[model samples]
Target chain A: MKGILKIAFKLLVNDKGKFAALLMGITFAVFLMVMMTSIFSGVLRSASSVVINIGAKIWVMDPAVTTVANSIPMPDFVQHAVRSINGVKFAVPLYSGSATLRLANGAYQSVSILGLDDTSLLGRPELLEGNITDIFAENGFLVIKDSEINKLNNPHIGTTFELNEHRGVIVGIAKVAANGLFGMPTLYTTYNRAIQYIPSARFTTSYVLVEPKSVELVQHIKDEVKKMGYVAVTNEEFRENISTYYKYKTGLGTNILIMTLISFIVGLSISGQTFYTFILENLDKFGALKAIGAKSRELIIMIVFQAGFTALTGYGLGVGLCTLMIGLAKMRLPNYASVVTFGNLGIAFMMVLIIAIFSSLIGVRKVLKIEPFDVFRG
Target chain B: MAKTAISAHQLVKWFGEGDARTNAVKAASFEANFGEIFYLVGPSGSGKTTLLSMISGILKPDSGSVTIDSTAIWTLSKDELADFRLNRIGFVFQDYHLFPRLTTVENVAIPLILKQRDWDEAIQEALRYLEIVGLKDRAQLPPFKLSGGEQQRVAIARAIVSQPDILIFDEPTASLDGDTGKKIMSFIKDEILNENRCVLVVTHDSRIFEYADKIMKMEDGAVTTIENKSEVK
Candidate 1:
């Protein structure tokens, strides 16, 4: 088996031009696949950035909410009801809304504002500078230092901006786990102040953030919340719901899927055609091997080994190339949202495996049909 | 008495169907003994190759059977027949058929590799066979790098490396000049043939026919004559 595999390898690589062409086809396919899926994965993660960054155990919201960014304001009674539920350690009204900020440059920019509970400051972003207590001062706000921070002229602690004719001071510079998908700067303020600064519906609570007393009581709390015509979901479930909404209900998902399928087809056609040509050209040699006593099974193994080796090599090259490109893009363009995840890798790997199998089958069919007599008769 | 190594009993083969049907080999019966060079000669389309294919266990005869060393080859299952070919026969093609990517020694090691021998041991054994063909110095070169005669010698070395009981050469010298052909035949007669092995040569190249101990002639699809060279002499 070792010797046969050695022969298989030699046969594949000895034709350097064909081998290189085969690798390039698969490598380009894998690059496109990983790039498309990674960008989509990153987009999904960014779309749920609020849930990921807030790190809440449970969120109580209107049942109609599909994503965190598109939150439907819940009435004040919902938060009070959530707080009254058994197993609820605490429930705070979270105010999430968009507001236009007038930067120091006098240019207007859209910003996402999150209002934490005034007393507990639950879900406040970690401060990179200044004191967290400063958020309670008059007109106090924490500016999140993310990719879009420069939109507000890169505000630091003590930087002041105008919102709805009200003075807003950056009391602290903060960092969160993920940046928003939309190109908007994020601001953190107290719940009462947020509603005061930004005009909203009569009900200003976007979601009721809940912390259960214990893990075992989470289901019971969810059941209790459901009776109030609101949905209760854990942090992970909320993120997943956002991901599902974006993936199934948006054109982005279909576009990415189509691109990935096209990449697979391109790789499959090129590799399959090239491999079939290679086998046709080597038909005489295969016939000779057959005539000299190589079994059909052995020939099939040789073809499979050749295809699998080429596919794996191309897959590695593609992943490496995509990683390098993504890294370089993120360095030069901060807003570049593409991440390489294990799921992306697995998808590309499965596609490459399918390409290998399809190509080898093409070659194997041609090889098995060859008769030594036909080869020798010539 | 010389022991029989190959026996074909009234073998027959045909191709196509209906109006296009053609008999490739018909009732061909013969015996090839150990320690002698047996030649099957015929014109183009005279069924020499078809008969050889059947006798070598590659093409199944429509009727009758072939037995090598008393084992009916046609009666074995497909896999068993393949194993039989791998273990009991050594075939050399008209074009040498050496894999161009492989070094001469590696080409010689193919049969041993197919037999599941250790790669290093097969290479070592192949080198020994290359040495026997007087091409040990060129063992590292690819088949295309070697001269036609040298390539044919490599093919011969590859065939005999497995030490099979029956050695079949199909038009061994069809592509070579007369002197090279005679030299290949001489090399085969001198170094390859032994008391325990049967050597069969299929060719219409009469220039090297003098080396054959017995020559079987075919016309159309049937054996026309069998000549014992020593007896005639």
Candidate 2:
């Protein structure tokens, strides 16, 4: 088997032109696939940024809420009811709404506002400057320093802005776990101030953030919330729900899937055609080997080895290229949201394997059907 | 008495089907012993190559039996036949089908490699056979770098490296000049042939016919004559 593999390797690498063509086909396909899927994953991550940064164990909200960004405000009674549940350690009303901000320079920008519970400040971001308690002061809010921070001219602790023509002051500079995807800066304030400054319907509580007393009691709390005509979901389940909504209900997911399928087909066609041509050109040599005592199984192994080696090499090159491009883009453009994850790599690897198997089957059929007599009779 | 190395009985082969069918080899029978060079001579379309294919366990005979060294080759399973061909027969093609990408030594090492010999051991054995063919110095060169005669010698070395009991050559010298052809035949008889092996040569290149111990002539699809050349020589 070792000898046969050596022969297979020599046969593959010795034809420099064909080998390079095969590698390039697979590499380009993998690059496109990983790039598309990684961008989609990063977008999905950003879509649920609020859930990720808040770190709440359970969220009680109206059943229609699909993503954290599109919150459906529930009446205040839902928060009261959630707090009254037996397993609930604590529950607080959270107000989430988007408002236009008048920057210090008089330029206007859209910003997402999160209103944390005034007493506990349960979801307050970690402060980079100023004091978290200062959020209680007159017109005081915390500004998150993220990729979209510059849209507000890079606000500091003393920066003042206007929301709905009401005076607003940044008391703290803070950072969160994830940045928003819609190119909007985020501001943190108390629930009372958020509703006072930003006009909304009478139902202003967007979600009721809950913390269960124990992990075992989360399901019981969810069942209790269900009876109240609302939904309760753990953090992970909420994230999955957001992912499912984006994947199935939006054009973004379909576009990415189509691009990935195109990449796979491009790789398959190029590699399969080139491999078949290689086999055709080497038909006589294969026939000679067959005549001289190479088994059908050995020949099959040789074809598979050749295809697998090319596919894996191309996959490595593609991943390396995508990583380098993403790194360079992130350095030059801070908002570039493409992440290389294990899931992305696994998807690309599986596609490349399919390409390899398809190419190998093409070669295997040609090689096994060869007749040494026909070759020699020529 | 000399040992019978290959014995064929009433071999038949046909191609196509129905009205399009044509007999390629028809009831061809012959025997060759160890320690002698046997030549099968015929014109184009005479079924010489087809007959050789059936006897060498490559093309299955439509109706016949071939016994090589007392083993009825047709009765063996497909894999067993492949093993038999690998260990018991060495074939030389008319075009000297050397893998152009491989160095000469690697090409010659194929049979030993097929036999599962260690890489280093197979190369060493191949080098020994290359020396016998007097082309040891060219072992590292690719087949394209060698002359027609040298390439033919590489094919010959590849064939005999495994020391199979039967060495079959299909029009071995068809692409070579007369002097190179005679030299190849002379070299094969002098160094490669022995009392334990049978050498079968298929050719119409009469220039090297004088070296054959027996010549079997065929016309159309059947054998016409078997001439014992040893007595004349």
What is the TM-score of chain A, computed separately for every candidate? 0.98, 0.97
True contacts kept of each: 0.64, 0.77
Listed in order, each prediction's TM-score against the native is 0.96, 0.96
Best candidate according to DockQ: 2
Candidate 1 structure quality by residue, lDDT tens digits, B1-233: 99999999999999999999999898999999999899999899999999999999888899998999999999999889888988889999988888887889999999999998999999999999999999999999999999999999999999999999899999999889999999999999999999999999999987888899999999999999999865434
Clashing pairs in 2: none
lDDT of 2 at B115: 89
List model 1 lDDT by residue over A64-108, tens digit each. Answer: 999998889988999999999999999998889899988877999
In angstroms, what RMSD does candidate 1 have relative to the true structure? Answer: 1.8
What 10-residue stretch in candidate 2 chain A is worst by lDDT? A330-339
> Interface RMSD in Å per candidate, to 1 decimal?
1.0, 0.9
The regions of model 1 sitting more than 4 angstroms off are: B229-233
Evaluate candidate 2 and give its CAPRI docking class based on DockQ.
Answer: medium
